[model samples]
Target: MAARRPVDDTTPHGTTPHGTGYGALLRTPHAWTFLLPALVARLPYAMLSLGIVLLVHDTTGSYGLAGAVAAAAAVSQALVGPQTGRLADRHGQAAVLVPTVVVHACAVAALIVLAHSGAPDWTLFLAAAPAGAAVPQVGAMVRARWVHRLAERPALLNTAFAFESVTDEFTFVIGPMLATGTATLVNPSAGLAAEAALTLLGGLAFAARRDTAPAPTGPAAPGVRRASALASPGVRLLAVAFLGLGTVFGTLQVSITAFAEDAGSGGLSGLVYGLFATGSMVAGVLYGLVPWRSSARRRMVVCYALLVLGCSTLWAMPNLAALTVAGLFCGLAIAPTLITGFTLVETLVAAGAKTEAFTWLTGSIGLGLALGSTAAGQLIDRSGAPLGFTVALAGSGLGLVALVTMRRLLLAPAPAHRTVARGGAVREEAAPAARRG
Candidate 1:
């Protein structure tokens, strides 16, 4: 067995301290209860893109049509995902997830039936939209639960966020493999069917973990209103940054596939891409162990800068061997950046809007993926496989520029708590350190 690392209680700024390590964080009451189900509920997200592509491609025999159908789902999901989160924040996660999971199951089932029946392409898009839109914001809700569970304990919150990112990386890496292999090996519809099955089962189970859910937001006093998470400039900035990461994700998927096919090793694409997630998971585990002094906002900037530098090397990688190694190095910055961004967002929004804020960041990534994949696909067709990487690099460059230029906007200015009292008058109180993360 590995030796236990001692927790330092004297460390300032929630860096390294008592029970902040991964082992300790997992030991939190009922941690596995909520986390395992949340992880299962979220695995479908990783499978959906490839699952859709496979299921649709098989039925239509037109990759272009299949892609368009998938894109519609992705775009609608991006637009509607945050709204589910907003509702969850107000009504509690169970209230939102129960109904959302039902809707998602029906929508996905309808989509599968429509495709298999040779239904018109428009009908497929119609089913796809709702199917995508109803995807539970389980990941965001999980983070909100962590925030609530670890409140007044920032170090553990940091560890929890890092662990979340690591799991996300793991899911994405594994989800596609499960989806694709199941589709090809069993039947085209099997992957999507399995995805729906997992979501239904896991989402309901997660919803039942109400004890860990955040307190629902109650009605504001008459003549007073709560702020939407998007109203915060910092939240918007982070959303755009996540969008940048999404673009990189989209670009890489297509570019790697194309590169592998060109090299007569298409079968190796998944394993090659898996390397990227491997690097991210490794970095995320290590990230949670260190005790950093800088604010999450500063860490976001630095990690993103590293991301941009990493992306710069992708376009010039000469072969699969070099690209695979470069991909690993480039991915090293991703989880750290993602973990820092989530930590920062936790500080930027109010308790009532935290889930919404997290959803916006996640939804932005979905939108970015759609945009990036579309652009990269066209570029790859017109030029070559290597050109697809340019989209990833460009997205990173633009996002870095935006991040650096608007770094000030990334800080949280809203008071940590708001009081509505005495004839609906509201008073705001700031907890600067807590708000700064």
Candidate 2:
């Protein structure tokens, strides 16, 4: 078992411990050990979709097929991810992750082989399906651990979540460049094989850290029914908002690639696209370090509004250079919006339902990715890259609209109390009672 550090009662609410900064969380026992592996485990989340697109398109010479296959994989993940997270909540991360990793790795390996062998289109989709269904929800699991470990220190918990968001942005920045470079420079099979290897190694390493894993929620008491996190109007609104964000991301990826190809710099698409994440990552790190006085919902609204404005700039960028600049500005809003959304999820759901809630949130993003990719691909194919930008702009506009209309639903009553169970003892903590207007 990991060593338990008692919370410093002297620290006031909404503040970190008196002498420690956000950096102190990393110095806490086993923090780096767990975080490094989890980071590795999540790389494939960024890699696989783009990797599949590159691999299938290079082999089949059809962007349509490539997009459809990628969309299928994303849809499968969205369908299966929540169930896997629920199992992890009822059982444990190691138990759920070990088998799922094996299946996912095998599926990815099969995909590489099938793509290389000039297999039929149907066979490619067959290989892609299991990979997505079995992809471990490592990000959600890691956040759950943070929540479990820092339940008593709300301020530190917020910092930890910010750190996780920054890592996510970092993964996208690196993962795409790595995938595209490997596939373009070496061979498509090699890129996917690398992804498979990383998934296995990282999943195993993360699962080995049993000392820090949260205890399973186990079975509910007999005759006692529990409501799902989705039952909350706030959670539903947040999911829809996330769906919009996902559409922006998905469309931006496909559209940017198409735009780069049209500009005669296809090879630079990954690097050019990475600039977007670079901006988000820098912003996320800075966002995490500061204390914010605004409500999470308000922050989300402002960020979404900014996102729509940023994406609108894309429609006018006549070349890759201008688009890259627009991408940097567009990325500025992503991490802040996502951080606020996840923080709201934490506040809206019961502790027992956290892992599942996070998964559902992720699943919603996957659904949006599927929808966005499919629509953007067709639009780009028929009407060119400009129309693809329109899709992203429209999606962002919808998200901003949802936030404004549903702001009242999100202001519904927060739970009055929260319970944390540790070492066979149950402790009740008072939930913050304030609601933002």
Top of the candidates by TM-score: 2
In model 1, which runs have C-alpha deviations exceeding 4 angstroms?
A: 1-19, 60-64, 414-437
| Per-model lDDT | 0.81, 0.80
Candidate 2 local lDDT, 77-193, one digit each (tens) = 988998888788878889999999999999998898898888889999898889989889999999988888876666676677778889989998988888878887988776677
Q: How many clashing pairs does model 1 include? A: 0
- Model 2 lDDT-worst window of ten: 3-12
Q: What is the Å distance of residue 364 in model 2 from its true position? A: 1.5
Task: Estimate candidate 2's alpha-carbon lDDT, on a 0 to 1 scale.
Answer: 0.80
Q: Please give, for residues 272-319, the per-residue lDDT of candidate 1 as tens digits.
A: 777887888899989989877666777888999998899898889999
Query: How far does residue 290 in candidate 1 sit from its true spot (Å)?
Result: 0.7
Q: What stretches of model 2 exceed 4 Å from their correct place? A: 1-20, 412-437
